[model samples]
Target: MAGKTINPTRMELTRLKAKQKTALRGHKLLKDKRDGLMKQFMQEVRRTRQLRKRVEEGLAQANAAFTVASAVMSPEMLEQALMAPRLSTEVTVDQRNIMSIAVPVFHRAEQEAQPDLACYGFAQTSGELDDALQALNRVYSDLLELAQAEKTVQLLAQDIERTRRRVNALEYVVIPENQRNIRYITMKLEENERGNTTRLMKVKDMVLQDAHHYKS
Candidate 1:
């Protein structure tokens, strides 16, 4: 059944058509935004995949080195050598906008001097331990980058889904409803107009008959 629209007049029809036009324009804009976001989301996804692979490889290398070092060195000696740290790290978080979405950016403040990866005495610690530490340090920046990319991808995916749902609602629900209302109003108005025209014609015929009878 067609949905009923109250006061099916020309004015109402005009209003409904205007609303439909606006809805179509808005739907188009939202679709464009969704597409743009998808493109950016895919870019971030690819970057995250590559960074994750690199991070995993670096960690594996470091773990292998640690395993070799453990086999040769005494646990007590390793513990004593790595028990204390000499470097301090400061992490700061900030945000940047991407397509109206704010994403986190993490930074480790630059140090006055580059810290030595070697925390243990060379005389006592195995060279394998040093290699392991170096490997881990090498991937520190990559790890942060991977985190940023993954987070950006997550946010973009959420926004894309939201935009898509809204677009669908306008395309399928709001616009269609307005169109139905407009059609109903137009039909009602035309029907009323035809009825009025027929009534006027009947009145005109009766008046002419009365005049003819008076003349007779």
Candidate 2:
């Protein structure tokens, strides 16, 4: 399989050597990138786990508070109180590169000034409803952070897979093939040189014999 399509010459050998060197260098760089990405991915996974737990607990508390409030207050009154929301928020998305992977960053962009959770009058709403709203509000930042961390993990995983494939191709396929081709070309050139030297020696001996015969 070696040098089947390759020219067995010194020029071809030199070219293959240069190509092998480049492949090896690229393989090393990609391996480093993969390692760095794995490190960042693991850190992001840990952070996402923590944020998810916090968000879940906060949501559970809020749900319990809402249940209590619903039981104590009339349905009509509760519905009326929550009909109009006083706060408006927007989310701003940005990206940062980690090991050449672009990952999302989320920011809680408020359309209006930050306002209290109490959208309704205290006299009209139960304390339980206030607690529920406060609990939900507290988890918003963590929810955003969790989203960001999870997205980062996803992006890192994809880039790592891509880099791994390239490394494998160079290590298992490209480098070895080039090395075989180089050896084939070198052997062929050496054989040709030996053949030429043998022929030159034969010619020299024949010339000495002919000159001696002419002298006799």
Candidate 3:
């Protein structure tokens, strides 16, 4: 069975209004997502550069320490010393979202220094060798952070891409489709209005003619 025809003006106005509201909302959300992604991407890039530089500097210092230690301490002795008591460390991870993109929290583990491993006095080992080993350990921690950060960046980048695709689809496909439906509905409503108007005019004319004939 055919459904009752809706009033053209009211139906068209309602549909068009809804379409406009939805389109505006979608546009704002998509723009915010795009902006947030760009900002995060730039931040991560800068962090990667700085971390790489620090890690390299740490590696160089460690090489120097190992060389100096080799002169006085046998490799076996140093190894044995290193194998002694170990300091415990914990790494904490936190997660947050930036415009639907996930950000990873990275932390490094800390350790107590044993400068005497180099066969030097506590004071002697505390200076260069300790600093070097600390730096080396820090570099290792940074490498781990770098790995996590890179993985996070990759995932975020992928999300940005996926969101862009969805935004585009909404802008071009879904909105356009709704708009077309609105247009089609509007046309039908207008046609229905005109048909109603013509019918009413004819009925009025027929009633007038009948009255005129009866009065004559």
Model 2: how far residue 193 lies from native, Å:
1.9
C-alpha RMSD of each candidate structure in angstroms: 2.3, 2.5, 5.5
lDDT of each model, Cα atoms only? 0.87, 0.87, 0.70
* Per-model TM against the reference: 0.91, 0.91, 0.70
Q: Encode model 2's per-residue lDDT on 1-216: one tens digit a residue.
A: 483688888888889899999999999998998898888889988988999999999999999999999999999999988887777889999988886677888999765433665777888789999999889889888899988988888888888899899999998999888888888888888999999999998888789879786432
Candidate closer to the true structure by TM-score (higher is better), 1 or 3: 1
Minimum summed lDDT over a 10-residue window in model 2 is located at 110-119
Superposed by TM-score, candidate 3 places the C-alpha of residue 73 at a distance from the truth, in angstroms, of 7.9
Clashing pairs in 2: none
Model 1 off-target regions past 4 Å? 110-115, 214-216
lDDT of 1 by residue, 1-216 (tens): 246536788888888888999999999999999999999998899899999999999999999999999999999998887787555568788999999999999897645333575666789789899898889878888999898898999999999999999999999999988988887887888899999999998888888889786432
